[model samples]
Target: MPKDSRQGSTLWSTVLADLRTRLDAGEFTERFPSDRELVAHYGVSRHTVREAVRRLDMIERRPRVGGLVRTPPTVLRRLLDTLTALGVQTSRTTTTGEHHSVEIAGRLDRAPRTLLTVHTAVLRADGGPLICLQICSAASDSVPSELADMLLDGSDRESGQVSVVYEGTVPAAPDPEVCEALGIPTGSVTFCIEARLDLADGAPILQRAYVRPDRYPCILQFSAP
Candidate 1:
């Protein structure tokens, strides 16, 4: 395909076919130029750029759009940390890979209690394979429900950040039931996930999640400040 491809075909069928050929022929691999770059190089408009890479084409990957537009690792880390922003949903699935449950843990009025916890199977949006098993625990007496049950059916009304405050909380070890539920070894390092606990409490409360970092990662996105 010529850089300034003004073939003027209204129906991008031919153009798309050509673009796909270019892509398959190693024309747009490892990097996809921006609309401006494409225009400067190919004499196409921003509209053509959108038409080429619109959502309908299933081209959602960032590198497909911003080939060399690399983000600082720190910024990417911080963005990944915020689960909602990344479209990371919590749900459960049977061993047969059937969709089972979807729920959220809540908190109650200001009270120091291990309120809500959950065990969920994480899946990528493309739904190709199971990503990981996410076992989350909240210590705030905010949401009063079994963590597992919450995974089945629960509501999350508050928008807050889950953080880690202190280490070596009382009991100091993973709860036996939680360990069983999450299938983690008894001596595994359980992450102390301290969330904002934004419910009835004005200040942050202790929401501890005993996680196996090996299976699950603490995802956060960070960019150059």
Candidate 2:
């Protein structure tokens, strides 16, 4: 005779263990399997499946780097989550669109003539400038106006999947606008993170970010499976 089934929690734990093992083997690359699929495969209840997924999320916690908050580098994060984690208030400083530069266009896999929206905002700690963020996204006729509005509001909703992220320091030259917004001297260095999010077609959807290093130093940390 076959062995009896385990309890709900016990079965969930067993399934979670199996999933983790598979994850370590790089099974779920693009996206995780659906909860219903997991439930069917593991012979567990829907509640059990959800609890297992929740545990995976809590296995890792975000870290604070200076004034910036970043989640484990292994997972992708939305801009709002990162800002909210700082536990500080913020306000939008500027939101404008301009013709894409050759370099930026190349990075975004878009045409130089394409109009790209530049969204800039300042994060405040105790009513002072902590960091300034500038995000650039595609503003083509193909993209819906409502979705474009979200990007202008500094959101990456329905943007795409993050394919690559690069971090470096840019030696700033005399820029009146940056100097004014960040309250820093000309030629001051700025920390920048450029992420390339790609659609299923493998075309870039968005790229580029800028932050004040002095006020919002950031670090990337993660663990091996």
Candidate 3:
């Protein structure tokens, strides 16, 4: 039996091969050319360039609409700090609470069957909803009522020193609630990030966060290894 030669080739396949050759020859060092430049050079559509670059893992930073891209809470304890560093100010639009009465096992060393309080807020920048934050915590956590309310209106001083670790990220099609909040189309693809925040003692203070990445483009920085 012989392998089919067509199986490994595509219209964009040659583009990737050319890029790989250029990379080996030290053509790209710090950044890749813009999508427009690549399309003109490769004679392919912008979509082809995006998909090829994505498959080759040659691009990291996403195109931001504003001056700087929002760095997701991968490092900063305060998500507000992350956004501020990106040069954007956020205002909370709505806050809602969903309390699960049924006993549930807690994450990050909390007691089993602990009550969970889920607080969700839609944050805006420049008068448009930027992202939706769904934060969950153990109901026993000593969160001040005022502080909880502050999360709905603006940033607070107490929401720092918490270590945030991303648990997972997935692509999802927009639902009605998300579409309305982010003002995106009903079926647009959105990036959803789930993370856990823990106290200094390693106990979980905040269980999780759900972030909508449609409006908030992520800042991806890489260095030579």
- Predicted structure with the largest TM-score when compared to the true one: 2
C-alpha RMSD values across all candidates: 15.5, 9.7, 12.9
Clashing pairs in 3: none
Tens digits of per-residue lDDT, candidate 2, 145-204, equal 233234434344434423344433343442466666777777777655455555444545
Runs with alpha carbons beyond 4 Å of true place in candidate 2: 1-26, 29-86, 141-176, 198-203, 216-225
What TM-score does candidate 1 reach? 0.29
Q: List runs of model 3 lying over 4 Å from the truth.
A: 1-86, 101-114, 145-160, 165-168, 173-179, 185-188, 200-203, 206-225
Worst 10 residues of 3 by lDDT: 64-73
Worst 10 residues of 2 by lDDT: 61-70
| Tens digits of per-residue lDDT for model 3, 8-84 | 34645767777778876867565667777777786667666666666664345446311111223342234556677
Can you give the TM-score per candidate against the true fold?
0.29, 0.49, 0.44
Tens digits of per-residue lDDT, candidate 1, 161-218, equal 2222332312235546446556655654554433323333443432343344444355
In model 1, state the lDDT of residue 7. 53
lDDT against the true structure, each candidate: 0.40, 0.53, 0.55
Question: Which is superior by TM-score, 1 or 3?
Answer: 3
Better of 1 and 2 by lDDT: 2
Which runs in model 1 stand beyond 4 Å of their true positions?
A: 1-172, 196-205, 216-225
Q: CA lDDT of 120 in candidate 1?
A: 43
What ranking of all candidate models by lDDT puts the best one first? 3, 2, 1
